[model samples]
Target chain A: MVSAMICLLKMPCAVVCSKIAKRGGAAWISTLAYSLAVYAGAPDVDQIFSARWAAGIDDGRSQLFELGWRPEARWRFNDGGRLTGRLRLRVQTESGTRPGNIENDSFAPATRPQTIGETGELDLRELYYERPLDDWYLTIGKQQVVWGKADGLKVLDVVNPQSFREFILEDFEQSRIPLWTFNAERSIDDWLGGDWTLQLLWIPDQTYHALPKQNATYAFSSPRLAPQPPPGVSALIRSSEKPDRLFADSDAGMRLSGFVSGWDVSINYLYQYDNRPALHQRFISGATPLVEITPRYHRMHVLGGTFSHAIGDWVIRGELGYFSGRYFLSNASQAQDGVASSPELSVVIGLDWSGVEDMFISVQWFESWLSDYRQGFTRPERDNSLSLLTRRYFWNDTLQAELLWIANTHDNDGLLRPSLSYELEDNLEVRAGLDIFYGKRAGLFGQFDNNDRFYISLRYGL
Target chain B: MKIQQLFGMGVLLMLICEAVWSTPLPDADEIARRINARDEGVAVARSLTMRLTDRRGKTRTRETRAFRKYYGKEKRTVIFYLKPANVRNTAFLTWDYPQADKDDDQWLYLPAMRKVRRISASDRGDYFLGTDLTYEDIKLETRVSMNDYRRKTTGEDEVDGHHCYLLESIPVDEDTARELGYGRVEQCVDSEIWMVRRSRFWDIKGKPLKTSYFRDIRKVQGIWTQHRIEVENHKSGHRTLFLFRDVDYEHGVSDDLFTQNALRRGL
Candidate 1:
């Protein structure tokens, strides 16, 4: 379907150029050259087909097959300035999994289409234009603005929202949702006597994260009250309202970075609305037993910094962020209760070593702490996690084996992902992997213990 | 009269002994310095194609563009991969200092990550992009330091129909030898051009590791350059052939091309 569309788009342009050439127009050649360059340098299209078959290791009865295909194309304009656009299309079909039961599921209604059955989605990943000035750079349009330099865990990488429909199983690049924004950066090496850069960003659109559907394979199965009451139940229904499309409702941030003494360092600040919604419950009357729940987004201010340095054969990296006025669930018993506000801090430290030939290893530790711990709250005051990644290359680097493990130290829950990938040829690759989860049912990874499965995928680039 | 005759005979014997041992051999340090100074160019740019063949006869070809510039005692080089969709847009940059005591700076840019990462100096011994050449091999031409190695003029030999000087270079210490992954290297340097025509490397265990042959010597912008180079790994039974498609010497290169931003931008 995409090929046909591309042909249709090119036919008219070609005919017009030929006509101009016959009319003896001097500008025809340059015009034709620009068009040809655009065509020749058109971004390569990628098509991936994947199939997953998995069964519960303990029961050996719960089995499922998920088949999917993703096709994406990028078009880069050669109009002198850097301008590019990308279109991605995905289609998936699943067998042997029943439809989700929304009553027991915690996911919002918007995420229902992504969890089961046959579905298709179309997205515009990037549609941006970039220009470099004398000592500054500017970019505008819809794009993904990444921040921080950590792996596995995010400390200050909160510029864009993410999709948890796959429960962190997908690559972060594929999960981060793009936003419409303007970005600029200025070089200050001449003034600062060192290599320094100042960056500013403004996001004008309001976007929310997409969570897993209720009763889905990767969804949380713990008990929870329904977000919306049934019809004719004498209840008040209030949904999370999106911010208005105004400059006052936008988000903004800035970052200053430089390299000093063989170390890369940066400091950043941001003010924005929280991506996740908080629940506020209330009762209208005592005699009628009326219940009301309002979903609202709170404001937050984040201050963060990052640093990386290489020592001997190891590269050490660290990131820290502090969030002020963050909202948390209240421990009050009454239905008419509001979320409490508190300050939170998050930190991550990592090390990468590649001393052995064709082998590389990376380990990271991450933690989060809330200020002024309060008793009886559902959320913990401290959370600690660890992650490890190891990769080995063989057959002249055409084949690679990788193992990834992430464990929550505070909860004793963990996930393991092991994969082997082989490059069949230039622009073509095949990969197979196993995803396993283990721990108590209440833990994060343990909640999806039944979702353990294996998968294989083939990707071909044009 | 008899004492005078004995002193005169001892003086004659001493003079004869001095004359027999006074034919001075070539200084190894001077020879090595001449080899380093032979190819002089302020800047260079070239496009090369590398073909790597394994023991099973499987071949993989890669294309790249490289640029180098000299600023005082510092040399900067940047290389960008141009072919093979998976590896395209990847770049490597290096800044080498003339001072032997200072370590070189190197950075790698990966297009997929959109980030530039610093590479440790200890990892230079690993193979470069699945080729028979290591990072150290590509950097060997610029790292001629007399303090790290001892050079000796062994003999004269003919290489590729040209009479050349046969020289052997060994690490100054055992630790240096182990760190270089090679105990010694033998080179056949052309007498007329002072450029290395062939080189053979031996591992620390005194086993032959690899041999590299340079061919198709030509002058570009008044500098002698080798258009073709071949390296064969004895242990792995793998061979690599580098063919320079285009070469230019003393070309004016912008300093901005050597920065991390240029590496991330690619060619």
Candidate 2:
């Protein structure tokens, strides 16, 4: 059994190495080292199968059930090189106990592909190769890049577009969609005097955020629409246009980071297309009202900076970003043909404290301000939000209890998550949590108030 | 005339005795410095396995590969976890400075997060991965300076048939003691090799808290090292055993392995 397991584990590495060698450019020595490291460090196989069921508090009959499986492998080579691959498959089933029919749900189409008893779609979660040169490191292929230190906020962490199929119910790690890119970093500490590094990224694959399909679970009501006109009316048809696959369509970014005077600081700039589509509407000359809506991507420039400093037993962190030429949906009263462009600023500041034994607390305040405010924009001119996370460990750190609260001070909407996790063994863990939402139906969190649920999951690794 | 000559001899004898007694023994700080200097090397690598036993007798094991190298006056050490699928590829890097006042720079790379995070220096007091050892205990092997500790030679003791010097160390202030979570510590150091064979820790209330024993003493590459260490927490019926294997000294380790990027790369 052990030998079979070992052979099963080695098959993937052997296959990957042979393919790389056949393609050439990869050193044999490095390949051997990589394989050896994989054999030494990697487990024979790591598989996790989990099941979760949640029900709405207001209507107990409204329920959601999900089953998921994930398998992953990692390999490391000499000179700080690594390769990782992971696959995820999940199936979800939901029962609509609310007043609306499931067929009329806006998000139903998105969840239909992975509905109950259906063959769930397979997702390549990660497939990347990382290599470190003398003073520079390079990573290529599809991967996720995290750039900010803020908790529960996206100030400078806009590298990868997100999947909102489950709204904010999923972890960030699972929700982030990876993009194919060439990422490189070089150390400049020798000249900069501190632990300085510069990173460059070029993403060729122009991926967009995966929003929930109309009539699917967790779908929110939105004003943007591309309605199909009735056959009798003469309407000009315009289809959604996606950016072409070319070098010019690629996104580029740069970041410079360093540590100085006990502070970790970074500054970054990115030029990319907005993942979401901007609506362009046109009217046809006819007695009957007829309109055509087309979705298109717009360009944007983002400049951001982040810093974290330790003060005694507390860690203070902050992130700030300025976005130029961001598109916003026009108000209903406006007869605009397309979306409006605006500049915006966002900031987040937080502190983490562990003063009390076995307990940790983190608090953050975030704000976004529109530089030039007008009456025809979808969002408000200014918005403020706050988040707090408290965690306590028991049973020699094997059991943990956490409470997370995020509140939009402007909208008076909020979400509260209370979770408990227990490590049953070295390779097994169980977690249970409650996701509760409160306030106005139009607010971000308040819209999910009817979707409030309690869920439990069990995961075993190895 | 005979009585006068005898009195002169007695006075000379008294002067000789005073001259011999005036030479002082080495102070506590000097002893600590000597202990720190005993195991100096260019670079070292080791694979270690740790077994943790909880109060209910449940056990968990973890394995790691560790490398350490010295660059001028600074020391850099990096450790990577190599076992248990959940924590595989997790790495930690630390750079220790010669200056006692300067805090050590530390970073942790979590594979799940795919990022390197700068950790606070105050985390030294936290238990290391549910083990009975703290990050401070690992650093105490090379950091024996008495800048923040008041040390005294309590007398002599024996461990496993080897004669050892018993020393008591107390934090310089109450605040420092509270931060370290220890009121006092007693260490039994092997007199000849200057390696600590055993240590006893006391809580803030001066109650016995934990005891650690260093066993299986062996010499590798001219450095006396303890191949096994067992630490038991008295307050909680829990203990941990650390077993060192494949120890190598004078290994050619690259400076890049100590960097934050290297840590994230799992080098």
TM-score leader? 2
lDDT of 2 by residue, B166-249 (tens): 888998988777767788989888888888889999987899999999999888888887889999999988899999999888
lDDT digits (tens) for residues A1-462 of candidate 2: 986787787788778656545443212323454555555575234567776777777777546666778876666656556777666767655633211212212111211122223424445566677887776788986778788888678887888877776677778877777777789999888888878989999987666666654455676543322233346754443545667665888889999998888788999999988766666767676577776766677789999999987766788889999988776666544637646777889999999887666678999999999897677665677989999999998767788999999999987999999999988898778899999999887677887788788888887767
Q: Give the TM-score of candidate 1.
A: 0.81
Q: Note the DockQ of each predicted structure.
A: 0.31, 0.36
| Candidate 2 chain B, poorest ten consecutive residues by summed lDDT | B139-148
Clashes of 1: 1
In model 2, what are the clashing residue pairs, if there are any?
Answer: A105-A215, A106-A214, A106-A215, A106-A216, A107-A214, A107-A215, A107-A216, A108-A215, A108-A216
- As for candidate 1, its interface RMSD to one decimal place is 2.7
**For residues A1-462, what per-residue lDDT tens digits would candidate 1 score against the true structure?**
886787678778677656645544122432344364456566544454555455556666535554545443344445445655544445544422422322112222222123222444434455666777676777786777777777768888888877665667767766777777798888778888777888899987676665545445555442121243334456554655556555887889999888787787889998988766666667566656665756666778999999887676688888899988676665545323545667889999999897877778999999999895565344578989999999998777778999999998987988999999987765677888888988877677877787787767766554
- Top candidate on DockQ is 2
